[model samples]
Target: MQFTQLKVLAVSGSLRKSSLNRLSLESMKLLTPTGVEFLIYDKLDQLPFFNPDLKNNPTIEVLNWRKSLKQANLVIFARPEYAHGITGVIKNALNWIVSSGELLGKPISLPNLSPRASIAHAQLSEILSVMGGDILESCSPNASLITPYVIPCDTAKNLCDIAVINHRIRELWNRIETAMITK
Candidate 1:
């Protein structure tokens, strides 16, 4: 299949009902170019912990999650920082995916929306890369997309930043499209 027509799966790290990270991932889906499709996994909390003891007797949900990752041409991760690091939920989810062997060499981008920019973003990029995910690009929103964690007040300005983030996403897809052509 050509990259231009590939399906991209996006998963948000946060489970908050109004999570900015989830909003960011949805925005990416809305902004994706024609011929590309984005599917957001809303069941992060349903995944059990990664355990070798239970690898063979995996639950149906875990099996389905792995199947989705295998089918996706690329993965987009939008995460939030908890206590100056990636949340436990997101980290655990990554742990489960790592054992699937489907993520090796897959193109990925980790654009975040957080108040603790430098530390959280830097650490997450390293972690994902070390786990064999290709971290293509990352960005942190200057302002909170949700309330009470205000870094700024201009929604329009934040929307502008989101536009740039979407462009990078399209660029990644274009690369995938090109790679698909040669293969």
Candidate 2:
């Protein structure tokens, strides 16, 4: 049997340069099996606010964003909740893609790095549902207490949890079984 390689497009919802959400996505990339590749979309800050007025003629950045979605076999989002909601950049990206049929029937997963992510998770879930994204069940690492505020780079406790998440992905995503079978 032959299995096609899975291309996962991982988007970090946080815009800060030191976002733990981005770090988690990077870590996920490291943990994923050989047949799966996670492409971290680092251009959130480059996208402009979504304007329904401009849907007919989007900018080059918007065009590129849509192209990325179209090329991926799966989508992954790593986010830190802000004020009980998904970050602005991510929401904006979603808005831009709303008119285009990019997210329709797409399999999207989100890894929550904040214990306070309950509301944001539900909100994003509803949004993804409306956008027609198939949210993969129990696939995200929703294990964290780190706030969306400011966390230094030297936080060991959080790092330790993140380490476990790396292992969790393999177990939950069934990459281990897939790897064993492929071998």
Candidate 3:
């Protein structure tokens, strides 16, 4: 079998240390297919809200984050539902990239870690579409949690429901690889 290398950048909508969304990203890293590499963004909290008024010069952090996204072959967003929609932090981070058009036409995946993963999936799809992104697919694990805490190691066996989430992630990577090679 032949596989292509893909560099994927993953961003979580949650900033809390024990966020299930962040844990979902970790699970993705552990489950990535061969020839694929995943990088998780750990500083979403450091990003300032998008400001069109500060147009003359962009901050180093913002510029660097945008650069990373531009260099990535695929973008994955693991997010949670906040009051029936995506979190403000994730929305704000995306706003910063909207003007650069870095995500335009980029392949994206939105995976949810909440009990209401469907809500998160729909909300993120709308947000990404408005920003001009191409969403490859969205998946939600059956191991959704009602609370914000991380599932204990033993109980966490299903936290990511590896079978389902990994399959979707693999599919996305395959699509990304095909697009990269065909382009």
Report lDDT (CA) for all predictions. 0.66, 0.72, 0.69
Model 1 lDDT tens row, 1-183: 233567788888889755666666665665566777779988879988878788878888788888888888778777777778877887877777666676788777565556455467777778778778766652223334442222222342363265455555455456556644443
What count of clashes does model 1 give?
0
Instruction: Tell me the TM-score of each prediction against the true structure.
Output: 0.74, 0.81, 0.76
Give candidate 3's whole-model lDDT.
0.69
Q: Write the per-residue lDDT of candidate 2 for residues 46-138, one digit (tens) a residue.
A: 888888889999999999999999998788887778898888988999999886889898877766666777788888889989999877755
Give the true-structure RMSD of model 2.
Answer: 4.8
Q: Candidate 2 or 3, higher TM-score?
A: 2
Top lDDT model: 2
TM-score of 1: 0.74
For residue 181, give model 1's deviation from the true position in Å.
7.6
Report clash pairs, candidate 3: none
Worst 10 residues of 1 by lDDT: 147-156
CA shift of 102, model 2, Å: 0.7
Regions of model 2 farther than 4 Å from truth: 1-3, 144-163, 175-183
